[model samples]
Target chain A: MKNLQIFCVIGSLFVLTACRKRLDSFLFNNDNSIIEYKLDSYGGELALDIPIDYLVPNNDIHLFEYQIEDEGEDLNISAIFVGDLNKISSDTVILYCHGNKDHMDHYWPRQKLLSHLGEQGRFGVLMFDYPGYGLSEGEPTEQNMYESTNGAMKWLKNNGLSDDRLVIYGYSLGSAPATKSVGDQSFVLSPSKLILEAPFASSSVMVQDASILNMPASYFVNTKIENAEQIKKCEVPFYWLHGINDDFLSIESHGRTVYKNHSESWKQKNEVPGANHSDVPTFMGLEVYSDSILSFITK
Target chain B: MVLVVGISACGPAKFVEPLKKFENAIAIDVGGPMVTIPDVASMPIPFSSITYGHGWSDKLTLHGSWYTTAAIFGVAQIGAGATYGVWKSKRQKHGISAMLGFNTAFDVYEKNFKFWPQLDAHYYFKYNYKGEQQEDLLTKNGRKRSNLLYVGVGTWYELEGVKAHGEKQQDIVVPMLNIGHDLNWKKWTLKTEVKLIAPFSSNENIVLDYVSLTGDKGSTGVYLGLIRKF
Candidate 1:
């Protein structure tokens, strides 16, 4: 019996170790630097090289690199400021939370599009990389993401950006922190408006959708971000945009669920008929996409 | 992060089956795979199994068993197999059995199936009584009234069918050492086994490459069951 007990203890430890290792596998990170771009004037024709920066002139945008002290760790955060620095105090700022993928560099084009929303240079767009993404420091976790977002929000507040002049825009993975900030009272100030594009409903819903299985999320993961539950408490005007043919996260399961959960009286949804995930902007065309967002923010 | 926790909690591997069968008896085993270390922790998954055996002749028996675990996160498993036993003792006591079986683990979207072929050999030692030594410990009514202890060794080979994304078919061989006790009282018999299974070959790392965890090279587990003789 004693020998059996000894053996059992050893076995249990082995299983726990394996579980810890398994936990580390969910995060996929890459450290490739953001691509560089150069501009040159040509014979009376202004030609931009990259597809992303077509509308936004290079001189109007500034890239800011700052350090955020989170949980005793100093993490590097990369952000872009679009519009004049002097107008930051007076203009409504859009806190753009981007989706998961390579890093902030990948979403630089989206930031350019957002800068022109509601008339040219009318809104100042602030977009940054979450920790462990882009040139940011530390691995991405729920707690770290929240902390990083809070740090960015605080920096904006300290620089004369107030709650009434702020609009939160979350895309894909960015929706977690965006909804969390409004839903959980994580931030001291509430934004004027909330926008979710291709938002996932929650971790459980995501697992079920991805695996097409009836298994509970708890069996495999402990990350529970219930966007539907959080959106219920949002009091600001809510605008949701989703592609009808999004294969990664289904429109019915995720986008619609979150929209239905919001209790805000002023809530709207735009389901692009032929668009899929990640191509809504290109599919809607710059005119329609920009006009829709401009109208939503102005209204 | 939530992703880390999500990856850590997935997967259930096959457990050792101590090859013990009674002639002309039906047994049900109610237990699950367990891992020991720091403290004993079972898989926390629910499982039940039933086995039946019939004596074909004095030295031969045919048996079959089916086992299944309840679904968690849409994950469930069912296994069924047949065993051919050859008794060495004249009374059909000590024997070796060869088994062929297939099992499947599935979720709502994906299914994984495996074929298992195993060979188990055991020697039973009956209790010594004060007076008469009965080779066949059965009463006039055909009820068993003896206790037996057995030690066995088994080897199993498994080939799995790949169905999940990023998963590939795996072939694994496991060698196991088991000690068991069979208690017989009237129409009811109880069997319990302690098994130590050594991992001969496994592709757990390749299969769970997205996660950092891997299976142990060797592990100890236990199985307890009840058998009814007709």
Candidate 2:
């Protein structure tokens, strides 16, 4: 283990020293985005296996791609729409804003549970690619990702998904977009509610104080996205979902700080004791999160 | 509690397609079975493409490809400029040739490693021509070979999960160029070529081999495949 750790440090140095910048597109490791595939028929993270009927050779969920044309290289975005408008009406559209590490394809299982929740809530769903992600255009930045996600909101409206019943669901890095995206262009924001699962206090905090950020999360991170500051200005009900055991973004530091920023006028705060930073959907299940969303939207 | 900080920073050299009902032709020799296979399932629906650049004067052809099992993502390379030809009139052949062609590619080659341009060499040799309409004396025993190469760059781009000085990074400068060849005979084809790769021009350790404990520049990975294009 000691040798492995040493090698890891050496490898990290090489990764930094070898190329002047990002890996070429032709290279597999030079990736900053993802492809999100949904397994909506199930309720939680457990039943991820594709049902035989859905996999009956030649029949499967199709992928829809959209490219965001932004002048800034840091603003290119790609997105995939998983749920069918004809089959389910989620009544509350769940706009899934994902994290930083993996691509959209990495979260299909989690979204599948949300899809299942849509079946229960009678609402539709819309998930898009972040700029610098998967097929989306632009380089990545909190501002660019935020704008791209805002554009997705407009896309959802234009594609028949309205904002009156819209629910902003932010996960990990996605929290930045949801917070920063309150009133941007093409954003229909009379939102039903906002659900931030395992959200960080801010992007800078996630970098400075979070476990993922070893160097004081503050030393190296220059981009500052303060979701805690924006939540207070939101017009709709804002809901916070946190996995108390999260090792990456501490709930007390990031989540609580943001929650405390509400000035007592905000909607509600909910927590699942065991769910880690990213384990909110997988460990807690759609029923729990979906129910909280439904209760807030209905009331 | 020691946390891992991964910060990736690179240069401007590296920057970073599609599918179709590919009407293709091929020669199967080195990739799978030497002799003719029984049918489709016995063969690999190898979806690959190549290109020619610098006109006929440079003799510099570049190319690259990845034929998916088609069990994932989607299926069938569908579009124009898609071809599968056999090289040489023998059961198997390998050589070099030049031509002009248009293609649609689903893969890319990273060009520029620090300051060193990289290349990806590919090899293809067809051993069988399995088509319904074209089963002539050549179908009995003929081969093909070809090479395709492409090169280009990225303007505004980046990468994710890369470590730089013990930290993670999300973007980079990406540029690349590719070249490939196509040799056809009877119903077989052989393809080969190299791609120049370069990543961000600033940092110099993008291509480190820690396992070998050496600092090596980027390289040209060789791809060899075989299929019976129908």
TM-score of each: 0.57, 0.45
Interface RMSD of 1: 12.3
Which segments of model 2 are wrong by more than 4 Å? A1-62, A72-76, A86-91, A118-121, A183-190, A207-219, A264-266, A282-286, B1-230
lDDT of candidate model 1 versus the reference? 0.60
Cα lDDT, model 2, residue B170:
32
Error of 2 at A87 (Å): 9.1
Measured against the true two-chain complex, the DockQ scores of the candidates, in the order shown, are 0.06, 0.01
Q: Residue B227 of model 2: what lDDT?
A: 32
Error of 1 at B205 (Å): 27
- Residue-by-residue lDDT tens digits, candidate 2, B1-230: 11112221111010010111332333222221111122312221122322111111122322222122210122211112212221223433332232222212121112211111221122333333344225553345563322222232212233233432223443333332334334444334344433323222222211121111111222222334333333
How accurate is chain B of model 2, given as a TM-score from 0 to 1? 0.31
In order, what lDDT does every prediction score?
Answer: 0.60, 0.43
